[model samples]
Target: MNGRLIAIGDIHGCHQEFADLLQLIKLEPGDQLILLGDLVNRGPDSHRVVELARQHGAIALLGNHERRLLAARRNPDKVKVRDSEKATYSQLDDADWAYLNAMPLTHEVPELNMVFVHGGFLPDRSWREQGADIVTEVQVIDRDGRPCKRREAPEALPWADHWTGPPFVVYGHTPRDDVYKLKWSLCLDTACAMGGQLTAFILPERRLVQVKARRRYYP
Candidate 1:
C-alpha cells in the first residue's frame, strides 16, 4: 500500500504551529508530507520551519514569498522589507538557501493524483507549457481560461471547475478565510502569516487538519 499524502498549507514561519500540527498528525513512516510553500517570512522561526521540512524529507515547493526573498536578496539595495521577513533573511545560512533553491517550483505527484504548486496553474496551457508568471501568480479563474484577480469579478468561477487532470491542482500563495476547495482544485493557504490556522489536507482520506496559531505574529 502507498503512504498517505498529507498536503500542508502555507507555514509562514510558524514552526511551533507546524510542529504541533505534525504531532497531531502522528506522522507514520508510511505518511508523506508535502509542504505547499510560503514556508518563510511573516512569523518567527523560518529557519526552524525549513529545517523541520528538510529533516522530514517533505516536498516543499517554492512559493511567491520565497521568490520575493530571492528577488529582494538579488537587489543590492533594500527597497521595502516585508513584515517579519527581516528575521527570515538574517537567519538563513548558505545551506538553508541552497535547500530552498533546490526545491522545485511545482511537484507532480501521480500517486496522490495532484499537481502541487505555490500558485494556481494555467487553466488553458499544458503543465510544461505554462508560463512562469501564470504558474506562480494566478489567483482566480474565469470561464474563458483567464485569471480573475478578484473573487467579486462578474465572470469569476472557481479556478478548478474548468481545469482538468490530476483530479486536483493543489496550491497555496493566495490566503483565504477558508480553505479553497472546488471541483478540481484546492487552496490550502489559510493565512498562517496573519495568525490564522495552519492547515493540512490529508489525501485519499480527504480530511482536513488545522491548528490555530498561538498569537498574531504579523500585522
Candidate 2:
C-alpha cells in the first residue's frame, strides 16, 4: 500500500501543542508529514519547533512569517522587523536558518490531485505560475481581481472562495476560528497561536485530527 500524506496547519512556535499533536498522530515511517508552514514566530521556543520538524524530516513549506524572516536576514537594513519576529530570529541557529531557507513554495501530490501551499492561489491564473508573494501572503481577492491580505481589503472575498480545482489546494496562513473547508480548498490555520486548535489533514482518507491549544500565546 502507498504511504499516507498528512498535512498539518500553521504551528507558530506552539511546541508543546505540536508535540502533543504528533504524539496523537503516532506517525508511521511511510507517512509523509507536510507541515503547512508558519513553523516559527509568535509563540514560545521557535528553535524547538524547528528542531522537532527537522528530527521528523517534515517537509516544511515557506509561510509568510518564514519569508519575512529570510528577507530580513538577507536585507536587515531594508526589511522592518517586529519584536516577535526579532525573538524568533534570535532563537534560530544556522541549521534552523538553513531549513527555513530550503523550504519550497509548494508541494504537489499528483496522484491525489492535491497541492499543498503555505497561503493559497489566485483562481484566475495558473497556480503553478504564481509567485511567492501570492502563495505566501494572499488571503483575499480584491475587487480588482488581485490577491491581497484580508486586512488590506476587508470587503474582499477569500481567494479560496473563487478557486475551482482539480489539484485541490491545502494551505495555511490566514488564521481563523475554525478550519475553512471549501469544496476546492481547505484552510487549516486554526489560530493555534491565539488559543485555537492545531489541525492536521490526513490524506487518502481526508480525515481531520486536531489538538487544542494549551493557551493563547500571542495577542
Candidate 3:
C-alpha cells in the first residue's frame, strides 16, 4: 500500500519472460504486484510462472484460459486439449490446478483508482455486476451475451474505447502489438502468450516495463 502497485500482463506460460520482467522490475519493499491473469498455458512453463507469481506474493486474477483449464481439471473427460496448451496442462500439479480454479476473476483497489481483470470490463455495468462471460471473453460486444472475436477481431469498438472510469480498469486477454492507454483504462496484454513481449505497468509512477520472449512458444 505504501509502495508502487504494478499490474502484469497475460503470461501464457512464458515463464522466462515472466522472470525477466520481474528482475527488470526489481521489486522494492512494500511494492505489490497484480498479475492480470492467463498466467499459465500456451507457452512452455506454466508451472514456473504460477510458482514465481505466488513466490513473489503477486495477486493473480482468473483468465479465460485459466477458466478453461479449471473446467478441464474439474472434469477431465469433459474437455479437449489444444496443442499449445497441452504441455502446460500436463505439467500443472493438483495445487497448481486448484490455484487456477480458486483465483478471483477480478481485483480492484478503489482507493488507488484501479481495477485488475483478465478480459475487458463492460462499460455499461459495474465490476460487481459483470459475469465471467463479460470479463473472460470481451472485446467488441454489442450485448452482454453477444460474442466477440474471442481470439482476435478488429471490429466491435474495442472495449477500452468504451471504458468510462474512476477506478481505471487494467486488463489482459487480448494480445495487442502495444498497450492500450485509454482515457479511462490500460490494456496490458502485449501478447506475451503469443511470443510477444511480457509487459507490466507500474502504478503511481505510471511506468511500463517489459521483456521480450526467449522464443515463440505457441502458434
Candidate 4:
C-alpha cells in the first residue's frame, strides 16, 4: 500500500481545523504528512497541534513563532509583545518549547524534487545553501520601530518564478486569501489562525484541499 505524499501549510494551532482537514484528505496510516511550519502560536491549542503532528509521524518544520517562543524562554527580559502574544508564550512548557526548537527548518525529498520550508527560500539559493547550518539569521521588527535581525531562518526562503533549483517548493508563513501556486513554488498557508482555512497539497497530483475553521483560531 503505497501512500500519497501530502504537505500541509502552517497550522498555527488550529487543531480542530487541522484534524478536519486530515479527515477530509483521508490521510491513511501509510501516508506521508509534512508540515511547512508555524505549528504553534497565534491560535488555540498550539500544544495539541504539535502533539498531533508527532503522533502521525509528520515532518514538522520550524517557523517564526517557534523561534519567538525559544527567545522568550532563553531571555524573558527580551520578550515584549501584546498581551495575546505574551499569553501564548506563557502557555508553552519546557517540553513544548523543546519540541518547537527541535524541528528542522527545511525538509528535502529528492524523489519528488521538492523542498518544504516554513516561509520561503531566498531567491537564487539552494535549500542546502539556505539551510546549511542550524543557526540562521532572521529579520524582525523590534520595539524601537527598527528592523532587528535575529539568528534563525524566520520563514521560507524568498522565492520567485526565476528559480530553477527544484520543481516544487512548499511553504507557509504568508497566508494568501487563496493558495498561490507558481511554476516553482506553492504557498499553502491559508491563515487558519486568522479565520481562514487549513490547506494541504497532494504532491505529484498537485491537488489542493482545505477545511475552513469553525472560528477564528488565533488573534
Candidate 1 residue-wise lDDT, 1-219, digit = tens: 377889998998899999999999888888888888889888889999999988888988888777778777777386455755788888888867887887777888777677888877766667766654676667768666676565546567655556776547888877888798877888898888798999999978989999988988888
* Model 4 worst lDDT run, 10 consecutive residues: 132-141
| Model 2 spans > 4 angstroms off | none
Model 2 agreement with the true structure over 1-219: per-residue lDDT tens digits: 267888999999999998999889888888889999999998898899999999989999999999999999999999977776888999999999999999999999888888999999988878999999989989999999888889999999999999999789999999998899988899999999999999999988999999999999998
Question: How do the predictions measure up, each by TM-score?
Answer: 0.86, 0.97, 0.92, 0.80
- Candidate 3, residue 196: the lDDT equals 81
Q: How do the residues 1-219 of candidate 3 rate in per-residue lDDT, one tens digit apiece? A: 799998999998888898888889998879898998888877878999998877778889988888887777667787866676788888988767767777898897878777888887766767788888778888766544354864444446777777788778888887888898888888898887677898989988889998988887777
The deviation in Å at residue 177 for candidate 4 is: 0.8
* lDDT, residue 97, candidate 4: 69
lDDT score for candidate 1 against the true structure: 0.81
For candidate 3, give the lDDT: 0.82
* Comparing 1 and 4 on TM-score, the stronger one: 1
Stretches of candidate 3 off by over 4 Å are: 143-147, 150-154
List model 4 lDDT by residue over 67-141, tens digit each: 766777778788765465675676666666677778888888888888887765555444576651221222333
Relative to the unseen true structure, what is the C-alpha lDDT of residue 90 in candidate 2, on a scale of 0 to 100? 90
TM-score of 2: 0.97
Better candidate by lDDT, 3 or 4: 3
Every candidate's lDDT: 0.81, 0.92, 0.82, 0.73
After superposition, candidate 4 runs with Cα above 4 Å error: 80-82, 131-158
